[model samples]
Target: MSTAEPQSAFKVKGQGTIYLVGLGHASTHWVHAMMIFLFPYIKQDFSLTYTEVGFLSMIMHISALACNVGSGPLVDMSGRRIIFLMLSLIGTGAALFLFGIAQSFLFICLLVSMVGAANNLWHAPGIAFLSETFPKNRGYVLAVHATGANLGDAASPFVAGFLLLILTWQETSMAMSIPVFVALSIITFSLLPREKNPHASSNSKGMNLRDYGSGLANILRTPAIRNLTLVIAVRGMAQVGVVLFVPLYLVDVMMFSPEGQGTTMMLMQVGGMVASMIAGTMSDRVGRRPVVFAGVTATTVVIVAITFISNDLLFIAGVSVLGFVLFAVRPVMQGWMMDLTPRELGGSATSVMFGVQALFGASVPILGGIVADTWGLIEVFYMLAAFMLIANVLMFTLRGEDAEARA
Candidate 1:
């Protein structure tokens, strides 16, 4: 709404809210990233095939997709962003704890489904909250939020891996779940006092179902939203695919020790942390498309280079570069989508964005599994590179950011 306004015109509000939300975001990601370390062990314990592992990933995405579709409206109408965030933290921790005690593959799948749904529930409220709090600095603020994720992602694998050295995979998962319950509890409960405390007030009280449908249709019809969603879906597919398989690749082909694997994963997140800050701030001033285009392009190149790399040190370095390029664009994509949609519909818009990502990304792991099964783990990186290239082409079909702002 204030696209033409000067950058200095609006002073940022909810400064504490931003950091608190960021901390909450970190805990959510830490819960998710810890699974990467667990996957190798899960695979070994179950004697699962690659396809089965991929199927587990698919379950996670599908569950997330289902939750994402509904969460937006719930957050928008209920005006209980912090409540949903707290619920998400609790659900993820419960799932992780129960996962450690899981006795059967079916039970594990069920727990994974719970994790997927609960993890995604955080995004609608989290993104909508920050976007509303700092509309002008959406890109920068969201990037700072993303930096929390980078820290969590960076820390979890190493922690999980280190724990794995002393404890069983089951024990590591159970142990890690405790902190999520503890640390995030303090942050979320502290916010309860300061939150708008809407107590389930409906923002769209007068809008009927038909009105909501029309609003959604209009939003979807925008070529920019559709194109960005598709590009993001592809990127999500690559990201989820890589996350699902990379640990297995490190374990199976590279023969990396648990600590070595953890450290490498940590490096990738460190690169991502740096990039999210720079790219997020840069996108705020320069517009979203340039930052997204450059990052996605570089990501494609880095992913391609990763496939050819066999040397341990070189491959680890390449992964860090991949993280810098690949992760930088995520918040930019969210900011760009926010710029295009109505502010009131921010929750629904975030759902649409993330839901589409989950829908398409749901297939990535299974597909990547087939590719890995047919060729090798290294070949999955090739698949990811191709997906990025397709996304880059999709980027060009989008209207320029200035046009998006005007819309």
Candidate 2:
């Protein structure tokens, strides 16, 4: 086995950069939360059928799916971290601004597609940066990064909801763009040092379809990577379904107002933030598999319990636990992917994982909507519980050989 050099210590400024990535993640969550807030306004304005709303979501997720693949190679080749970060934030902000002003469904679709594409640019590189910046403590650093995202998720709905109460949906969306714009400016001016692309030597000539295909094939053939992807896919499907419909469940089943729904969603984010931190640290010490298994199992249990809770307070408590279990495992999973792939293919591998998950998540919102329309929203929660249980079983099948090798 090759002996790897010891990684440098994490600097104060480096931690600042990770915080920036967290803020960026928060902005993405804000956008997502804002969308939920806008749904009613959008439906009222356009008289959108359920299918039309579903199609709009499909556009965003599909664009994210495509961009995830494209951005991987771009990040690998350039290693211009700040430039990519700035572009992503600016582009997403522009899309949101346009979305606020968009006059028609077609216009909104186009703008939202742009938002999706731009949002896709953030995760892989931001995460890759966190991984590279804190190589020695990748799991913990990534966990911190994910926690930042949870904070954003927690705040986004409340911000959007507050704006919705005072202003129109378009105005609320326009207001959401301000923080991202500020982030872009900060990134543009920040004096962060550029790090060498870990994968630079792997594809000096740049990535092509054949190269990507081969790399992807290599990833699939690797046992650990294969299992990791399966776990992500299954958990992703259930997570997306619940997240997309949970607001509706609160509104339709529990009879919460929009503001109340937003508050409930915020609670989920708070739970997630706490879980991400604790899980990330624990996984680094104890190993990724155990943390992941426990998290997923706990999540499944919470989802099933949510169906039985009739009191609003009990439901909120259950959902909060669900949030913690759902998000806590993300950083560990991401760290595991990095562990499996060589540095040279990190971006590609990350992209493949995210892209596939996004595609899977894309299907979920629409499917959950359909199920909610036919059965009850409670049925959707039960179905997710069933899926999470299956995912837990699959997770147990994962070998820790890759992680063990790292040790």
Candidate 3:
């Protein structure tokens, strides 16, 4: 057997591979943000209520929930990390292209659901790939990959807004699909080599339902995994609450133009993009518990502030702070999970955590929509704050030692 280095250090080759994976990660959320920016246009065109608007994201989440659970193990089963990634990239383009042509509400929802599924399924394999590729730099490298999503998130609003000024929303959607085609071309022709999965437990032949169930059951049995999974579930509730309603508030209550809403989203995501990378590196040195606890605590405080503050500037500041803190928790948690799970089961492990997140993340928008329809949009922020506070309390359940464990 080969002598592998300690968990705290990385010995990765093909540095560009990390960047490429990061780019792949970025593409998922870039499409997501583009969809978000289209919300106003959709609402106006369809004469939709807040509930209907929330339903759009809700359907996507539902599809994502199912796919996230199965896709992780499938990636492990296939043993073709790069292949799954390419498919995800291609799916992104197809979804956007479909959206560009779709006329009815039903078809729009269907396309969104497809995009959501494709977007989410990437995380499991991508996380596993990076963990194997850069074992030593796990925190920073995962953060880089996650940072790509945030960059996509941050950039899309600005790009969409700029494009909206000149083109129809459908035209803009079609144009955005162009990047995926370009990215796919590069990935297809590029000399990116696929790394072997050293931790694959099943033989290369095939996996049965029993084997898949056993792997899943094994991951769910871990105390830390169960706890962290629940923590994210609660946090995701608050996150979806914020994301699903903020645009409505901007359009209906604040009377901000589409550009203003995009700018607000841009501020929050930009904060997240920069902070996530830094937080991941910091977690490697200080520990995941401190980073997550500190982040959730700050996020809770900011949510509370956003709840009360009505001024646009103050709210933007709050969004920026919330972005920085909330975004940091995701990658750090992934790194911690990687540290504890055996390499062979990393796929199932990541899936378990991500699937829990998707289950809750998908529901919140619809639930929050009901709240917005009943109480008002402002009330949703209060609920968002409450969920974040509860998540912070849940985070304390994570152990001191687990936080410091290296992969």
TM-score of 3: 0.92
Clashes of 1: 0
Off by over 4 Å in 2: 1-13, 49-51, 191-217, 403-407
Quick one: best TM-score, which candidate? Answer: 1
Candidate 1 Cα deviation (angstroms), residue 93: 0.7
Q: Per-residue alpha-carbon lDDT of model 3 for 1-407, expressed as tens digits?
A: 12344354244455677778888788878888888778878989989888888889888888888888788888766655677778888888889877889899999999989888888878877888788656666788888888998988888787887788888999999999888777777765652344343334323333566876787677678787788889878988887777667777877888877678888888888888888888888877776788888888888888777777789888878788878887877788788888877665677778877778778887777777788889998888888888988998897778766534676
Q: Local error of candidate 2 at 149, Å?
A: 1.3
| Model 1 C-alpha lDDT per residue in residues 81-106, reported as the tens digit of each score | 77788998999889989878888999
- Model 2 per-residue lDDT tens digits across residues 37-121: 5665686689875556667777778898999988887876655455677778878888877777888888988887887788778
**Per-candidate clashes, comma-separated:** 0, 1, 3
Candidate 3: how large is its RMSD?
Answer: 3.0
TM-scores for all candidates?
0.94, 0.90, 0.92
Worst 10 residues of 1 by lDDT: 198-207
lDDT per prediction?
0.84, 0.75, 0.79
Given candidate 2, what's the lDDT at residue 154? 83
